[model samples]
Target: MTQPSPHPTLTPQFCFSTVALRDFLRISRASIDDSITQNLNALYTPAGQGFDPSSTSVRAPRPQNSRQIAPSSCRAFKDQVLFPSWQVRSDVLNYCASVATSPDPDDPESVLRQVESERDRERVVNERLDPYSARFFPREARTEMLAAVVRQERSVEKIIRARSWGLVGERCGGDFREWEEAMNEWRKAREK
Candidate 1:
């Protein structure tokens, strides 16, 4: 009978996609729409006479130069400025949704399992989009992988340094040629 093919060993791999990341954020935002609306309303009172509890008048503030003016400006500014801001936020939410739905290029398992928690996903996207923040993701995985390789190399070097055969003639109390021969034999045995 023919022998069955040997099973391949699994190795860790990094995978990510802009589309998947965006979709994840979108789904998370949709799940929390009510909460978001409430929070936005709390933070920015809608333009109306009773919008602001502190104001004696009934009108809401106007948006000027992208800043919300006091509760005394025209109501049109609120609709034009504040409402559009919310719309932009909603667009961002949609972008996130697209990302979450996209297929991962590196690791299919991670994409299927949604290994990145919703909060972490959000944080990563937010940080990435921030103008002042450094890009720490989408490339961090590769950076970390390279660092691990370097660390492993260093460890191997240390082991070689500690071996008696690795010592030079002055340290081994033998001829340089003898030490070299011993080291070569040691490497051959290790390979086997």
Candidate 2:
């Protein structure tokens, strides 16, 4: 009859849920998540294997760096930072997101420029409201914050960077909801 479907394990949605799809596409989970449509195209019509998902293809290209591993469009939310003007840079804190294990070429000589003018700081800058560092934070929000901070630029205000750094370090800690509240306040004030 139907030859019992050669591959019993594969399912329409399983591929999407599993890492195999990424390995097949030669991209990272972040890359796939960043642009599912693009990755799907690549998966269905792979540059390798002559457009045959069944056929084996050349090994996926290895990324030289973490960022390259994922498409640039991928937003690292946890890595993102919110500034006084409210600009999103997505690349400013790439390495600073974590404690540097090794010397980084991208490290800023000084974050002195990140501070705001006296009036601006006083008007817009809010003190770290949460006096106690959080013992635990949900994983999802942390991940989102990383992406959000990564988009920020070097010229960003220090207070914003401080908050982000604190969050990442889990020191000046809170959850995404708290962050949203603060950001919304800053955003609304700026708009008016």
- Per-model TM values vs. the true structure: 0.22, 0.16
Model 1 misses residue 34 by how many Å? 62
Candidate 2 residue 107 Cα shift, in angstroms, is 39
For candidate 2, write residues 58-158 as lDDT tens digits.
66665333122122212223223123212322121333333223333333422332342333445532347653433322233323333343333233434
Summing lDDT over every window of 10 consecutive residues in candidate 1, give the lowest-scoring window: 1-10
State in Å the error of residue 51, model 2. 68
TM-score computed on alpha carbons, candidate 1: 0.22
Give the alpha carbon lDDT tens digit for every residue of 1-192 in model 1.
111112222122211233343343344334333233332334343463345565655566754422232333222322333223333433443433343345436643444335444534665345556865544334233334334443443354334333422222222132345433544554466469
lDDT of 1 at 190: 46
Kindly give the stretch of ten consecutive residues in candidate 2 with the minimal lDDT sum.
Answer: 1-10
Q: Kindly state the number of residue pairs that clash in model 1.
A: 17
lDDT of 2 at 45: 22
lDDT of each: 0.36, 0.33
Query: What local lDDT does model 1 show for residue 66?
Result: 28
